[model samples]
Target: MNTTMNEVYVILSTYNGERFLSEQLESILAQQSVSIRLYIRDDGSSDGTRAILASFAQSHAHIDVEYGDNIGVINSFFALLRKVPPDAEFVAFADQDDIWLPDKLIRAVDRLKDASKPVMYCSCYKAVDENGDFLWQSLPPEKEISFKNAIVQNITTGCTVVMNGSLLTALKIHQVNTKNLIMHDWWVYLVAVCFGQVIYDREPSMLYRQHGGNVVGAKNGFALWLGRIKRFFLYRKKNSRIAQAREFLERYKSDLSTEDSYLISAFLAYRQAGLLKRIRYAIEMPLYMQKKSDNLILKLQLILNSVH
Candidate 1:
């Protein structure tokens, strides 16, 4: 790729991440084959995070830091996204505690360079502990990435996501209401699948740290299954996937294709319908999660009207 074409903007949100902030910044700076401008927004860190960020900013010309109130992760990321330069052709999301590989940005840019429309690239990641010990490698999605699947489940990991300029433009145009938003990455996946393209890379791009302070971490085996069940039952009203879907449809219905709009409308309608209709919709709608067991759980949730 041409040197000028390889420029990328990376946005990161930090919150009391002093323990691994410097290491993460060093890894981002070490990225190869791409010219990077790192924009970091500290979400009101009370720890040494602001001091560490100041030191980096004072020393590095390409790094810019913004210390702001704690508006939560979703809004903080969106704020950083708005700060990205308009001329930027590619943008990637970063976590304050992960160790990015040298080729992470380059690999994502290579995949996204030729896209003409809105497109997103996301890769698998290696889960590690706070001490950087290997935990496990995330598996690739067994099914196709589609709006139907995205409406129900998020397979995209934020730190590994990269997007073309077109998608960023679309996101800016259709601003999201963070009230019911799930995660920044999941929202991006939903938009890309509905309006453009989604590329899921099987290659591991970074060391995803599974530490106590992590906002979200990878879980596997029975632990993962049990956690999902707990969230579905215990936190249904607060973290409803149905509410997220409803928000997406409400905001983008006009721009959505006929089939896509109909699918979402039907999905929302069935949930609000009577018991028999809800059961039929649960069995009939083509929407699904990545895993078979998870898909079954989704159907059960729909049948019982527990998604709300």
Candidate 2:
């Protein structure tokens, strides 16, 4: 494959992101070793975000824009995915606030160069404040990225993701209920692990800016950690992950491998299973979060449900 000739469509979903949008776009435009095009969707922004998009699209021949209703982040991303050009050889998800490194797209394309089927590449990034000052680096990959982990948690963040055209085509075909997916990237990871491949790169590639504007951002430190514990306890009864997993299973049951099918079945059934049954399944389920501490907390949440 000619890396230089590959047409990559970078999809960006925006709301009120006029502040950092230009910087993010500039970084993306600086990528080397591939032909890049910017495709943006404005999710009913009331700010100057549309004006910024309009200005960029008018000056940049490769930039395209779409404006739609504010149907929520997950759906907005899915809507963007649906409109990706049929001939696009690769697709990368972009955030409105983060600044990507120069090599981000090139590295992802190179990693996925020899893939013969649907595949994905996602890398780590530096967590920064709204002003782009460093806060911390994203946690290194502590566990294998698998279908099991994808079912419980979304480690494949959209901003860090670059996927092949085949994966894009397949996703557009088997499109799950976007509303049911906790996130678009998670659904992409699930499909890749079940049918193709997913590569998790530990190298930092972007400045993941943390501001109140992020749909989801890095939450490090004691207060954020404590708030998570409180939120989990408060809303444990309505676990969204479990609901998303259930929806995934029902929609794509025929496509999953026999082993994955069984694992998902066991995971979904854990809530209703007897104590001994739940324990055995939980022990066998090889799911994990990015950190060991997070894994321990997940174990606690599981126990609470089982013994309640």
Q: Write the per-residue lDDT of candidate 2 for residues 1-308, one digit (tens) a residue.
A: 64446668899999999899999999999887778988899999999999999998998999989988898788888888888877677899999999999989989998887887889999889988988999988765677777877777777778999999888877877657665667788888888887799988889889999988788777778867876777666644333777788888887898888989987887777788667776675566576666777677776666556311
Highest TM-score, which number?
Answer: 1
Per-residue lDDT tens digits for candidate 1, residues 69-162, read 9999999999999999766799999999999999999999989999989999999999999999999999999998999899988989999999
> Residue 251 deviation, candidate 2, in Å?
2.2
C-alpha RMSD (angstroms) for model 1: 1.3
- What's the lDDT for residue 233 in model 1? 73
Worst 10 residues of 1 by lDDT: 232-241
lDDT of each candidate versus the true structure: 0.90, 0.82
Q: What is the lDDT of residue 35 in candidate 1?
A: 90
Q: Please provide TM-scores, in order, for all candidate models, with all chains considered together.
A: 0.97, 0.92
TM-score of 2: 0.92
